[model samples]
Target: MSHSSPASSASAAPASIACTSLDYVWPDGTTVFDGLQVSFGPGRSGLVGVNGSGKSTLLKLIAGELRPSGGTVRVTGEIGYLPQNVTLDTALRVEDVLGIAGTRAALHAIEAGDVREEHFAAVGDDWDVEERATAALAGLGLGHVGLDRTTGELSGGESVLLRLAALLMRRPDILLLDEPTNNLDLYARRRLYAAVEAWNGVMVVVSHDRELLERVDQIADLRGGEVAWYGGGFSAYEEALAVEQEAAERMVRVAESDLRKQKRELSDAHVKLARRKRYGQKMWDNKREPKVVMGERKRQAQVSAGKHRIMHEEKLAEARERLDKAAEAVRDDDEIRVDLPHTAVPPGRSVLTLRELRLRHGARVDGEFELRGPERIALVGRNGAGKTTLLRTLAGELDAVSGTADVHVPLRFLPQRLDLLDDELTVVGNVARFAPEATPNEIRARLARFLFRGARAGQRAGTLSGGERFRATLAALMLAEPAPQLLLLDEPTNNLDLASVRQLTTALESYEGALIVASHDLRFLESVGVTRWLRLDGGLRDTTAEEVRAEMAGEG
Candidate 1:
């Protein structure tokens, strides 16, 4: 259940956050925000936009990580921020990590005399600290884990929950979370959504999770450098967008009609004037009765000038009207399209064969593993358990120190870090670089299909947001002339919003190739139809789906 605060109370005025005429410009002369004005208040709010739409950048501005180039961004109360993906050092234990904040709060409360001396004595300083830490962890479903367990030893899902626990301990008035559920497992993601649903404070969440958005009070769509605040959740926002797009389309049609009419009228007037001129020239060349012919020619010329002026004015007015309508239509609805080439690959009976394969980092070793073709597999383990290393070896990016690796078919890999991208190039340029055979126009067209259009296509890869870079890389891989028969992905959902991840999932579901992915996102794994799992501890072992679900439950 959600908690009620004074802001939500009947007598209190609704709390509001506002950005007034904000403008943000990068060092490279790119303008992300221009005269942008947005207001949000108590309850959950979603920030939605395509990749490179400055969603994360705007979140940072609100968090004070950046200052607006021209206007102001102001918030009424304390702000709590959760970044998209972050790694905590393994040296710090969960309790010690949470203690850093609890200790400070305890000291502040004591300094302020919030508790009496006797009360303090009854609850030992260290005891109270541990109690508070435990409560925080429990709230986030991490209470069962040993307090001394190193943060770095946690899995991707565990780390996300812990970070949220830490954020919650602060109890800020406004929470600014950027893709809070990016790396969470299915159960963890649901829990995170519950946490957001339970929050009473004002929250501006930058995420692509449709389910999460469904729980929000409002959705703020960031598009074309502006923010549109919808009164309801995702469904309502989508309905509204559809209505707006329809209206824009109607305006475009009207504009086109007016333009055609204007052109036709202009053409007719030109034809009439040319005919009169030709007649006058013929009379002059024939040297017919001078006075009568000259007088008639003069009269025709005067009439033609008058007609021309009237037609010019009408045409200009029509053109201006069409331009105005076109402008309105353009402003109301402009979307980037991503047209990924679907390459055809010959069906192969056996794509990959792993027979008693073992993997490990330098000195650490794991057990025997086996895999086959046309199978959907998931690799699950803690952070440093060599999940990525295993994928690398399977993809032939790395050589296994001991186990034999065998593959009978062509393969493609999408790494967690997007190592395939060149940071210096634009989104389109990067695609062209990877698929050098594609024409420049084809590359641009394809990039647009991925939602990198207009100036965004020109954005440097290093400067593109994490989501943008991922999309660009994925677009490049999928657009290859002959798609790989076996696809290997390591943490594919790392930086994507829930929506993008789902879209990608839909695409993968239709893929004909075999897939072996290493991810902490259980939802993504489930969405992609992972039939079997390879759990890597000291070694690899095949386990039932129920067993993996049990492990997740146990971790929680």
Candidate 2:
């Protein structure tokens, strides 16, 4: 890939992007990047960072979706951009999104004996636009979707894949995707993974999806207003980061020790100077020495003390600054730490049961389905397979089309939309709404564990970012009035940062309750200790994560 020679290689590549002295600031006066110099050459690069790290903003700038506050972005070839939040008009057809609607309409018109010059112009030389569009859609696991299907007919995951297919049909030289797999199911994500793997042109993806990042040729870590390049994928990046963090920590310790030593030396110098002054004063007061001799001695002592004091003070200041720099190098990866003993369920207690369950979105449980004990279940399926419908039914937020979904324990559901929290209230007030009996102090103490401490807990829910809102909603659900013994989380990891996902995993570690979370996040499912894998396709069936991965890879 010649990452070392980005200048030469990127210039020659048909698809490339270069950002020179780039700067961006939000409308609210929050600075994201300043004088950021970055370039992308041929081959895939995974752009990763913490939430609000400007990865997406950089992509937008490159794609010309946004104008940089300062600096310039240069790009070669046509760009295909799939933003993090995709909004398509539901009234549009598949061909419209794939940008072949005009050509298709023109072809059909000519076939109907209206051989107009306008039709010929619209068709151009692309008589096979329909074929190409179909192939693109099929390549992304949308083969079953017809060209006439409305955008409203597709699920969220399908829509994302459709957008990708649209981009592919354009045959753009450069592709920029921001969190492309946010709502994708395991199967849909596999299609994305394959697409990313097959990308030969320049591609820069901003994603937290582990599997997707693993497919990239390189990793560009955006941090502290600059980008650092790693030669390999996510695993290699992690290893490199671990090594760097370890060294940074060591440097911090050394700097701290040096600062302490300097402080002590400064203190000791003060004490010694004071002692000398006392002795000199005694000599002067008692008239034990000649006046001229005493005066000269005192002057010498004052000069020497002043020099020593200044030297010691300067050394201390330098040490403190060094210590601060060293500390800055160390990353702050705070995790959620909480215990939910009240949510614990006994070993053999029944949590939830479904009988002949038929969801509104075309999913059905074949027979009596029972979840007993503190079972951690991963509900896997394709989009529109009724995962949300099932979760909502169990939470009593929606009634089943026809069947019984009984919840024997006090349960709480974290919906995919995260619409449970009131926008007007603060995080404290939101959680307080769920735990009405709990005092404000008690609620604040619990919220602190979710990384909402002090004034942060008072931040309004509406003002919270995607990651913060996820945590706040989670906190509310986990700390509800009765304390959910059975939890229903629908894509809980969606739009969450890596740290927030880890926080969720940590929080789940302390939870001793039954859990049925419908998510396609393979790493997340593994991390949270999924006890069972239930594939809710035509009917509920037991499956394994490996099996699903194999199926997605076309191996099964």
Q: Judging by TM-score against the true structure, name the best candidate.
A: 2
Q: Which stretches of candidate 2 lie over 4 Å from their true place?
A: 1-31, 34-37, 61-76, 285-289, 338-341, 421-445, 453-463, 552-554
Q: Quote model 2's TM-score.
A: 0.89
Per-residue alpha-carbon lDDT of model 2 for 1-556, expressed as tens digits?
Answer: 0111123454355777888888888664657878899999899999988765777778878887778888888877678999877778999998889988888999999999998899999999999888888889889899999999999888878899999999998877889999899889867788889899998989999888888888999999998889899988999999999999999999999999999999999999999999999999999999998999999999999999999999999999999999899988889966666555467789989888889988876778978999999999999888878788788888898888898988898888888878899999989999988989889998998889878998889888876756677788888877777778888899888777788788778878778999898988877889999999998887989999899778767687
Per-candidate clashes come to 9, 0
The 10-residue segment with the lowest total lDDT in model 1: 1-10
Q: Put down candidate 1 lDDT per residue, 155-220, tens digits, no spaces.
A: 666787887887787777888888876656555665787799899989988876667788898888
TM-score of each: 0.74, 0.89
- Report lDDT (CA) for all predictions: 0.73, 0.86
Q: Residue 226 deviation, candidate 2, in Å?
A: 3.2
Deviation in Å, model 1, residue 181 alpha carbon: 1.3
